[model samples]
Target: MRKPRRPDVTTLELVGGAEALELELHSYDERWASSYLEHRRRISDTPMAGKIEIQHIGSTSVPGLAAKPIIDIVVTVDDITAEEDYLDALVDAGYELRVREPRHRLVRTPARDVHVHLFEHDDPAVDDYILLRDHLRSDAEDRSLYENTKRRLLSKRWDDMNDYADAKTDVIAAIKARARAARGR
Candidate 1:
C-alpha cells in the first residue's frame, strides 16, 4: 500500500470566493490594538488555560502600517494537530474554525474580521512573524519600503486573498532575511 502524502502547510489556498477577494487596505487605525487585546482576553478566559499564547501579529499590529482592517493574530498552541483540545472552547468563545491542516489551523470571528492562526509551540513561523513585525516597527526605511510595496500591490486586481498575500512574498522575504541577518541568526 502506498502512503498518503502530507499536504504543504505554507501555501494557503484561495478562500471565500470572489466577493471575499476584495482586498481593502486602510490607513493605520488606533483601535487595532484594543481589538487585539479584547480578543486575547476573550481567548484567555476560555478553558484552554496555560495551553495557548495569543499574540497580535501581522500588518495590523504594527503602528503606522497601512493594512487591511482585519486583525491578524497568532495563537501558539501546545499542539497543532490536536485541534479538538481547544477548538470547541475557542468556538464557544466566538472564533469559527476556517482552515484545518496538519501544521496549523485558522479561525475567525463572526464578522470575519479577526483572523486567528494556531500553531504548535516553538513553530518557526511564530519567530518569523515576530521578527518581521519588530523589524518593521524599529526600522523606518524598511517600514517605508514595505508600506510602499503594499500600496503598489493593492491597486492590482487579485484573483483571491491568497494571491494578494502571495504577491508580497518577495518583499517580505527580502525584509525577513535582512532582519534575520541583523539578529545574527
Candidate 2:
C-alpha cells in the first residue's frame, strides 16, 4: 500500500493568505480535549452533523504529549472534493478555510488555535492520523521520541508551517511504521 503524503505547500490553494506559523510547543494541557469537544459540538450543530466522521487527532489528542496548543481534528466526509457539502457550514461556524488541496481541506478558527482537516471517508490520510494518534497514546517511547523531535525542530526558523511539518516527516513515518507493525498489518 502506498503511504499517504501531504500535498506540497506550493500546490495548496490558501483560502485566505498564509497563516502565521508559530513554533512554540506547550506542555500537554487537559483543556485541549475540552476545546476539541467544544469545536466538535459546533461542527455537530452544523448541517453536516450526521453525515461526517470526526476524530481528535495530532499531538494534542494524546495525553502527556507536548503540542503547539492547537486542537487538530480530522473529519471524514463523503466527498472531500465537494466542498459545498461541508465547507460553507464550517465557515459560517467561524472557521476560516485555510487550505485546499487534492483529497484535503483545512479550516481553522480565526485565532488559529483549532484546525479541522477534511478528507474523504476512505482517504488513507485519515487512517494515518488515527493510527499515529493511537500509537502515541499507547506507546511511551514513540511519544517521547516525537516530542523530542518537535522540540529539536523548534530551534530552526521555518518560512512556512508546512516547512516545519515537512521537517518532521521522517520521524512521523518511522513511528507510523512501528505502529502499523504493532497492529499486525
Candidate 3:
C-alpha cells in the first residue's frame, strides 16, 4: 500500500487563492451519482475521452456518507505532466483550473460544486481513492467513524477548504490502513 504524498503548499501553482468558504456537509443524496454521470458524459465527449480513465471518488461516492455537496472526479491520463493533452479540453468543457502541483492538477466548475482531479495513470493515489470509497461503502463502522470525524472537524473555523481537508488526513489514513489490511495487502 503506497501512501500518497501531500505536496507542499508552496509548490502548488494555484490559479485562485484559497478563498474563505463556509463548509457544510450534506446528507447522502442519490443525485450525487447522477451529477457524476453527467460530468462523466461531458468529460467523455472531450478529445481525450477514450484515452483516459475517469472515476467518481471521495465521500460523495459512498452511499449513506455525508459529503460537502461537491462531486469529486478522478481522471487518470498517460502523463499528468502533459497537460496540453487534456487541460485545454477540460477548460473548454467549462471547468476552471484550480490547483497545479507536481504529478497532479485540479480543475473545478466555476460554481465550485464539482472538482476534477487529474493524475498519471499509474499513480497510487488513484487506487487509494477507490480503495477508500469501496471500504467506506462496505464497512458501516468505518463509514460512521469517517462521518463523525468530518462533523467534528466542521466545528473548527477553517480559513481555507484545504485546511479542513488536511484535518481529515489522519482519520482517512487510519481508515485506508484498515482497508488495506482487510485486503491482505
TM-score of each: 0.88, 0.91, 0.93
Q: Output the better candidate (2/3) by lDDT.
A: 3
Score each candidate by Cα lDDT.
Answer: 0.82, 0.88, 0.90
User: Which lDDT tens digits does candidate 2 get at residues 153-175?
Assistant: 98887778888898999999999
Which of candidates 1 and 2 reaches a greater lDDT? Answer: 2
Model 2 poorest ten-residue lDDT run: 1-10
Higher-scoring candidate on TM-score, 2 or 3: 3
Off by over 4 Å in 3: 1-10
- For model 1, the superposed segments whose C-alpha errors exceed 4 Å read 1-19
lDDT of 1 at 86: 79
Error of 2 at 174 (Å): 0.3
Candidate 3 lDDT over residue span 1-185, tens digit each: 23334332338887878888888889999999999999999998888733799999999999999999999999998777667789999999999999998778999999999999998788888999999999999999999999999999998889999999999999999999999999999
Q: Report the Cα lDDT for residue 86, model 2.
A: 91
Rank by TM-score (best first): 3, 2, 1
Model 1, 82-164: lDDT tens digits are 56677888999988877765566888897879999888768888888899999999888898899899889988888767678
Model 2, CA-based lDDT: 0.88
Candidate 2's TM-score reads 0.91
Segments in model 2 whose C-alpha atoms lie over 4 Å from true places:
1-10
Q: How many pairs collide in each candidate, listed in order? A: 0, 0, 0
Give the Å shift of residue 171 in candidate 2.
0.3
Model 3 residue 68 CA deviation (Å) reads 0.5
